[model samples]
Target: MACRDDDYRFLPIVDAISAINQNVNLVGVVLETSIPRQFKGTDCFCTVKIIDESYSSPGLLVNCFGENMEKLPSVHSAGDIILFSRVMIKSHCGDVNAVFNKKISSFAIFEGKHGTQFLPYQASANFHPRDEDNKFLDCLRKWLLNRNPDESISLFGLNEYLPLEDIRVGEHLTLICKVLHICKVQENKWMAFVWDGTDAPRANMRAKKENEIENLPPLQLEPTPLPRDVLLKFPTIGTILRVVMEDDNQGLQLLNCDRWVKLVNVKCEKYAGLWRCMLMPSSKLQYLSDTEKLISESQRNYEKRLTLKRRREPFSVHLPPPSSMMTETSYTEMPFVTLMDVITHPKVTGKFKCAVRVIAIRPFQSEDFCSPQGIYRITLTLEDATARIHAFLFAEDSEYFFDGYPSDRTLKRTRNALLGVMIPSGRSNEEQQCAQRNPPWVQLCLKSYYTDKNDKWGTRKYRIFATKVVD
Candidate 1:
């Protein structure tokens, strides 16, 4: 992988890491990178920390900005080589930094393999690499090969790792988990649901007070970037911890859906009776490779969860026997039918028992479960192998399902167990497809009828009744 003397001749003469007060071209190994985040109106930016032979202890920081992500450095892994062209040299907070010039700054990223061919997998549209750049890339690869891999690419700070399920309130700790989904809550705020395949400890809740229910505002909606189908694939039975990242532009740019990441210095606290994790000012985020030990542990837990679920009552048990239900109003013994049969039955009004799994629940937050009338009104998206439908769980049925009146904190765990938690099954492609399937089946009594019996063709609705979920 050694480069010839002629290859060195084409490169511009510049100091390895000491160049200051002047624009200079440089090459360095990427040590860290921020997730790209949108700023201003349409412009996006990210920061990359790099190191070279001359600057070994600490890395030099480079600030990259572009009209869009396409023009920024897309550094996917540590130890990659970045070739900067015409970057402005500047000082920030008493530290030298490279400021990207939109008009003249350009970058090219090369994979850090020792003997791979000299080629840039990612580069700006205007970047045109000459033979000299290839030589520099080769030299960097050789240097990377000779250095100790552990010391070269190991992430710094907050080495202690804690499981999502083990986090205690008021504790600031680091955690490694897979990011199932990231959705904007509001301006400068995002909610990232992360899971490590283990169930989170239930939060402590206080008894409800009469004042708690009075003068509450109407329920409002929170915007999420994920679509229905994507959300439906989230894990049904594990602890999907909610993480709030506030005003963290660099951290936001660093995260992506389905990626495994290490969250450092996250503050865990209880909010509205549910455990919540937030990123503090000192918190740092590092992307983890698929081979990370914590990630593997999470995958094992995920698989075990699915195995336990399979051992539950089979869907066939819910299939109706030869003797059908005698009468619609007969509470003695009603035969169970598939969800499809319940929905498409010829009767304009009918009561039936079906086997289904709860997929998505509306209101998103448990706090909104109470209606203005002080009754619990929740909508559940239930699905069986054959069909998917929405069924209303309100009034007496809602209270019965929850075993009592629903309160924000007291029954948060119960509500989650009934509605199921949302997290993708795994980070790998194959396991991801498996997450799309519905969870184990449970028997539910559903009443299907038209809003107006006179107009049979009008809106049809389904209501869940006489059903209770047991832990």
Candidate 2:
């Protein structure tokens, strides 16, 4: 049968193992095959042992039953690469297995030179080349080449690392370790304490400054101390890392000019998928797993707790007093401009801080706006005491004002507000009252810009992009 477009794309066997109960696609070389067998009063089934280069040791067992079994080519044998789609992943004991769905799953055997041609058993099935698939195959080929005994210091050889305790001073070594803690030691400099699985002291490594880091190759996928937001997303503590370092006077440090540090955990297919979802708008996060949803909820609650704790704590008397220069810095730097100033001075385009009342909020029509897919936009009629103007918030920015709540109800309310209609349900009395207030107030940090609307007036319109929610 034809696989649905929603069927999972091909993943490494390791990822298929992690994503149990979900549909998966896999491409593997068949190591062994079994003849079709029938159980009493049940459908005939066949089994095949296949291996993808991503995993070593025991290969994956694919069980094809019913129509899938009937559709298997008569000459299918070992050494053949097959692409399986829409197969359900199930855990049997401690091992993962792929079970074919009778109606929606299909397989294609790659049959030509360079493995370009895929012959599908069923006409309804669609098979096409994917960039990720090609990249995976290329990686697999490199791995296979490295596995040959004659190849010395192969590309995949870095997986083998010497024990941290075994290294002597002045000796260059590769080691797999986990980051235990990271702290900022100086401006643009950070220290990381790492521990490999050995009876050795934790290695302290310092990050190179921008000037030194600039000398490294651009294509190197090495792990470094990331920005605060990016660092929070990574499984830093307890996640494995591969690094090539030298035993120096100050214990182990990264080799001065090479791209040797690699964060291994994020390379897992499941984590890679989660990272992609994070980059998307809040609307797109719905497809994430229940585990991810729980993690996000927990993180939000923790942040709320921290905020409340900070609010309750009084300022310490021992803290140093602010300098006169520091006190005046805020007034001198980036002063908030009035809405009238923004409208009159079209050339003055930059970030502005302002407090305004939301007179009306108009949600843009999804079909009319040529926005990036999966993103939604809202227009706010914001007015200060002097003048009123429109500010636009898209996707992530809109979600922030809505208190990180992304739902059809929120969209409906914005749409209704644009038409001056009331939905009048689902919300509590307090919320309804708040919505009916004379004017809703909001504080904003906006990016000001001017655009020619090409209207009957034949003049440019001033608009602001809502970059942040201050209140």
Candidate 3:
């Protein structure tokens, strides 16, 4: 570890966000991040706020865009550090902001901790750090250790509770919901299914196809999956959001299935045509008691839903009940079951008849439907008034469902046909609400079984069989 002239390449000196007067390099601790959304074609865009010891009270806003998400900064927590090279500062809508320059700007992110060295956890393709950068990082880390946690909370501004039903995509807000199931997806990723006894707005499927499934780490749910009984307890009506939690997230320590808790600094976004929530590094989780006012509010909502159900006319609703749409299938005599009944049945391995509407299709890419080995694979998220569950159609089953291998051209038409509801932008709120609460139903044969016979608790699955789409 000796000194060399070649190693001392000239790098732009770091400038404070407050003091920067021109296009320059800067570094600061990440305080907040908006959901990364797809821009034109394959590009990604997001808004982030950062602060340093020099300007900690009023953080600087940055509009970040990248050719792809991999090029964008991944700030896992509030105290993480980001380094921007050759960023241009601009004023927009009466506020000063930093904009990423595609041609010249590069970025790097480092874990912000007291003793962590000058190594970056993520960086662009062609980024190199200067010798002076190490000392700058050291200075910021020490300042962060002495920073007040309360000050950070005020900047986060997550005091109000947003019911799940009222949440709009792309907004970072707090929520008070009940967790039904929690399980590890991978070593560093966890998934918690939560609901507030109210349904989310209609799922929007008009987003860009290429951005449907952003490249991220795989969600490996096979190992240590949620127990079957616990999964069955998931609410039948209303929305159940999949909340992703990172390994280092503080909420991971406090959250458990079946508890009512408050989620602060959570961002809502659409994933695979359905709404999903993310717990950011700056996010916090606190458990609530039964007597809390928020709990009472949620209870009243649930009661209101039951009242609507009792008052609504059976066949007059926009979406009819499953029984009303039941078809004359060959498995009709086998005894039809609700989506909830299918999962809670004692048999664990049998064919059951049910009526459900297709809510979502995955993997979003048509190329993913056909494997390189020429095998077909598709999963449909089906919903009934009783509950929602994923039913698979693979190999021959997929071919039969589509009459043959489905091409990219016919995918949308087929998906819409199966979905039964194509919500347009101009639909009235009353009509949209009616459609979301009651979607048309279709009859099918669903087979339930455990993936591993030896392990019955965590390996249960459901698949579609003897079901074909007739033109």
The candidate that wins on lDDT is 3
For candidate 2, write residues 1-471 as lDDT tens digits. 222366545778877777778777887755444434442355655565667767554678787776433454222323346677777888988878888765776666643113443343232244455555555455544554455533312222333444333433232233433344444433433334443322221121112122112332111123432343433333211212322211111112221111122122211111200101001010000011112222345345435533542221112222122221111112223444445444444243556654444444443332322255655465666654334466776666555545454466555454333323342579775554344323323345566654544441223243434433222
Stretches > 4 Å off in candidate 2: 1-8, 40-42, 73-75, 111-471
Q: Model 1: per-residue lDDT, tens digit, 1-471?
A: 112323332222224334555566778877667656776787787777777766655677788889876677877555678888777667667777887777777788887744386778888877777876777778778877776646543533324678765778775687878788777666666677777765455433322222123422111123432454444556544456778754644445336778877776678886643466877655655666565455676688667646652311122444332233211222326655656466556675789876555555666467788888788887876755334567898988877777786456656655444444333435664443233322334567888878876777456789988776554
Which 10 consecutive residues of model 2 have the lowest summed lDDT?
277-286
Residue 92 CA displacement from its true place in model 1, Å = 4.1
Q: What is the lDDT for 100 in model 1? A: 78
Per-residue lDDT tens digits for candidate 3, residues 1-471, read 211224332122223344344565678877666545456676776666777766675677777888865566666555677887766777666777788866667777887754467778888776777777787788778876665756544544434678776788765588878888766666645577888876665544433323324432122223453566675676545667878853333224235567776676788886644677877755655445444455777888777755663321111234454345523244645645567667677777878877666665677656678788988787777765445677888998777666687677676556656755455779875664445322345777888888888987457788898776653
Better of 1 and 3 by TM-score: 1
Instruction: Please state every model's RMSD to the true fold in angstroms.
Output: 12.5, 26.4, 15.0
Who is ahead in TM-score, 2 or 3?
3
TM-score of each: 0.57, 0.28, 0.44
Residue 205, model 2, lDDT: 18
Q: Where in model 3 is the C-alpha error above 4 Å?
A: 1-160, 188-190, 206-224, 245-247, 281-286, 300-341, 350-355, 359-416, 419-445, 449-471
Per-residue error at 237 for model 3, in Å? Answer: 4.2
For model 1, where is the 10-residue window of minimal lDDT? Answer: 211-220
